[model samples]
Target: MSDITNAYIPPAALTGSMRDFRVPGGIDLLGRTEGFFKWQNLRRQNGLWPFSRATEDGPSTVCSAQDDSGNKMRGVNFASQDYLSLSAHSGIKATAKEVIERCGVHSAGSPALVGNTSYSVKLERKIAEFLRMEEVVLYPTGWAAGFGVIKGLVRSADHVVMDMLSHSCLQEGASAATNNIYQFRHLDNDYCRNILTKIRAKDKENGILVVTEGLFSMDSDTPDLVGLQQLCHEFNATLVVDVAHDLGCLGEDGRGHIGMQNMLGKIDIVMGSFSKTFASNGGFVACKSRAVKEYLRFYSAPATFSNALSPVQAATVLKAFEIVESYEGRAQRDALMANIVSLRHHLRGAGLDYYGDPSAIVCVKMGSEGLARLVSRRLPELGLVANLVEFPAVPKGAARIRMQVMANHSEQNIVKAVEILKTARQQAEVEFEDHKRPAQFEARAVA
Candidate 1:
């Protein structure tokens, strides 16, 4: 999190706030406004801004919004992480149907109590194999995996050194452990190395876990896995990577970024989500060591207290994995990347501001929170939908429209979506001109 005091703002020569606007709230409102203005300016500086609206509702198509008249909108979803188009896959549906027929719905109790079944074991084994781990533990959600893994692994006396921009789960996990925490600058290898050096000298005997994400969620940037892995090895620190955004899309055979970066054996714990790429709900943590797996099963709260995934969800994800492991998987992965490249080219050609290496996810920073939300609301008017990130999720003023590409989005659909964005940009510019004050005031002549 950026310090409120040190937050970046745009040059006053750029966008200026209306001094006469009557704000309903007091200092809180003013502070919020200042933060928003700052965020907008900073995003503009980085050339990252956009909004999301609704589009279609099918596999390989984007869904941006749903209008009040039961209509869809114009925005192409650049905000979804549904990489494999599994949400609408027939195979997934059929497998889920089979599970429903065989086991009915909902686990009757938590897994540690009574919800355990052969299905659970089967799913766990499949997940472990898919990620090249010896064992895997399931969680109710991706956040749960992060939280539980941290709490389960780190003791009160231990320290956790993490990336500054790590997800909430990583932060919460560290908090759950102890106050002995060190956060390195985002994606800065030198900063990470310095932290490791400091930790080695200051807390030599203390247990340490170095955590980072495989692909950063907001910016779609990948960490230097080779450097990080080497640093972890040199410092004798356990390395954990959350591949929530990179699984099923980046790795060879969709194993994940760890494998993609060839950091497989070097990484100690691998965490990821099924909700995004797998088109299912749940989270997982995989490790090569059986002892770590056993420890997590007993010590992890989400694993012990929470119910296992329903038979249908388990079946659905299991089938999705099968597709991911097959020749069809290669086809889908290529299609997904192709779409990603096409959309990226469109955005870049249009001179739209965006961030990170173009892959599955891209975030467009829309100058200000107001503009970001306005674009979001307007995209649906054009028949599209996307996610608007602001405040706590991102920075206070660093709002953006985050977009995700899927294997299903067709070339025609991509063209249509880009055309809509171009049109919307023109309209937005016209409105901004109509509402904005003139650049200079003319000298009043005596009548």
Candidate 2:
């Protein structure tokens, strides 16, 4: 061998070794030892810590479940939009079962082409009557209905006015048509009027479609329906109210927001989801006139291409709707409200940072990605699962967890969840204050 002093190690050999070990700081002798030790510690910490897994493998609370080391952790299902607990209802199940037995699985064709099942037609008629409209069209999903209705009604020359916080589907459907889409402040009728006036002044020939939701899903707030309807009429704008979150939970008879406000005649188009109150999958666009119905049938792409609601799905949703329209149906809605009020009182009394609105949905504003993740992990340990929404779903710094109140969840469950939230927030405050990052947790402060 040549003199040892002339020896050299190839960079490629070192790189290969480093890649094998995955040592941070590129595997300098001392750094390699430190990195391995750090890796081991992290592995142990992660192994012992709470990670949600959907499988029935670990202790679960309201928000999390843990599987094995290599599996994806399961999230507690507070993110679901099922409001009336209809999906789990016995009557809906029985009806669906019967339909499946009688009509088979799918309708197997598009409604416009050949797939107009008897159940689908009846459901549409029932939905129309429920919304106090003369004609309605069914779609594959609520988003499909939303997309079809917006794209069908608005023209390139028309101005579409939507709530700033409207769903992505509504925004996308309108935006795809033209850049003339105007978004007004959430529930601000005055803003709507001013924008409509401006649009009418400059483009008299253009039509205006004023769109809003019966319930603002995020904040659990209601729109100023009476005021909005008045503005729409005065400005020649057709009002389209999307009742996805409110269909089964609001209204006296659970007919939805327009029913509660007694503005059924004032609204031009009413769209809703069967997934929520009806306890099934599909959506409908209820309108007062056959002309609009005929136009929607011919023009709406979603209605044209989307499969007709399966016979089973239609039957299930119809049964749920029947329940919703009955006296007992009204009781369920009232019970849901009672639960909401009880939850609001409990959360406020516990100094929890919940939105506390008197609606079907409640939001607990937890600040920071780290804290939201931590709480989400801890919540399941307490036996309650909720949704931990972080950046992108909301704003960067405004992470929150949303919960929907259903007739299925008991007062005890609500109270217990609030208690756990209080304890969790108190623990977080102590930890974050010690770490000098207390400002990252304003949600706890709001509590």
Candidate 3:
């Protein structure tokens, strides 16, 4: 087989009798599926695929996780996005149980049908009040909110300009919404402005949508919301900001990136997910006009077709909103910031390359995919759990271990996780070196 073919085919596929099958051609849908399986197999061989490690306990500082081999290991969890550590809060749990008892487990139907309960309405009101928006609409999941909003508002005649590194849901929504989709460089307001100006020159009639995230989870970075808003106004475009990663975690009263940037109530639309800090699985979109909210309610697929947010989830998020607006929430945010600072300091002192600003997430650069996968596999064994981000998720050669810090993580837990990570890095480097030497020797022998 040619080296290119060998590079594409996984080691497992090349073993045994499977190597006899011819490689697929073209980048069609079937070919893409075949490529995905091939890549998945390669990741599996390197212990990088099947990343859904089951957690025994809820989102906490530490939890019991099952590895790929089904072996349970208790460790400091740096993989969860529970920024305020509210997912395991006793009050949230109790509220969920009470709501379930009163309203049953399911919503029973779509909100347009029989699903809009008093709990849902109350939660919507509370969220709108917290964000200072005129109205709020809830969705079954964050992905649905992103997808449904874009698909609902923008048609094929409309145009969408998004950040290059926006979440997949936003990108998918844009793709589904319009044919005219443009992407600016990550966080590059000038590039976005240029794109908008160029598009406006040609299509002055169609609606234009500019989409971005309040905080990018992978890079743990935020955009210049004020600048983006200015550009949108100048170019006559609507701006939508997704605060899934920042809301309920940053800014005073958890108003998130918009508040931090002092652009709250300035953007056209604001959306966020509850799973991060609200200790529940759902999402919402807030807007200034009741007309927009009503339009989305009738046009959005999730609102019109999908089942509504369950009563239990609505109640949990409502209680979470109450807590987030309280003094206790400020204290939790302070603790989370402290943990971030502590972990970043340790990482810097160790002479490691990390990315992004101070937030709940800290990404330790690994430089290569092999090193990242190896280190990630070793972390579970070292009593630490972190997420390995590599190619496709991030640009090639920018692999890293993304660590999420929680408000509940003790100083000891932070320090110990850093120590364990250092050890894992060393072990992975040694193993990588050992593997590279053998592979090099075999290649030279074949040559």
* Candidate achieving the largest TM-score: 3
The per-residue C-alpha lDDT of model 2 at residue 314 equals: 83
Index of the highest-lDDT prediction: 3
lDDT of 2 by residue, 277-360 (tens): 677678889999999998898799888877788888888888888888888788888888887788788888987666535777
Q: Flag regions of model 1 displaced more than 4 Å.
A: 1-78, 430-447
Q: What is the per-residue lDDT of model 1 for residues 1-447, given as tens digits with 9 covering 90 to 100?
A: 112112222333123333323353566755657655555445444222332223355434655444333444444555566788888788888877878888998877776677766777788999887766788888878999999899999998888999988999989999988898889888887898888888788778888898999999887888888888888888898889999887877755786677778776567788988988888888889998889888888898888888888777777777888898888887998898888888888877777767788678877766665455445545555655556676566765676777778888888777776676666565555544433444311111111
* Candidate 3 clashes between residue pairs 3 or more apart in a chain or in different chains: none
C-alpha TM-score for every candidate: 0.81, 0.80, 0.91
Q: Indicate whether candidate 2 or candidate 3 has the larger lDDT.
A: 3
Displacement of residue 363 (Cα, Å) in model 1 is 1.6
The deviation in Å at residue 210 for candidate 3 is 0.3
lDDT of each: 0.73, 0.72, 0.83
lDDT of 1 at 354: 75
Superposed by TM-score, candidate 3 places the C-alpha of residue 376 at a distance from the truth, in angstroms, of 1.0
Q: RMSD in angstroms, candidate 3?
A: 5.2
Which regions of candidate 2 fall more than 4 Å away from where they truly are? 1-79, 431-447
lDDT of 3 by residue, 1-447 (tens): 123212322334212222223355565746545755665556655455537678887767888888565767788989898889888788888998898888889998888788888989999899877777889999999988888888989999999999999888888889988889999999999999889989988988999999999989888899889999888889999999999988988986788888888876778999888988888899999999989998999998888899999888889888888888889999999999999999999988777778998888799999877667767767766789888887677887788999998999999998899898898888778756654665764664466
Please give the distance, in angstroms, between residue 65's alpha carbon in candidate 1 and its true position after superposition.
Answer: 4.4
**Candidate 3 Cα lDDT to native:** 0.83
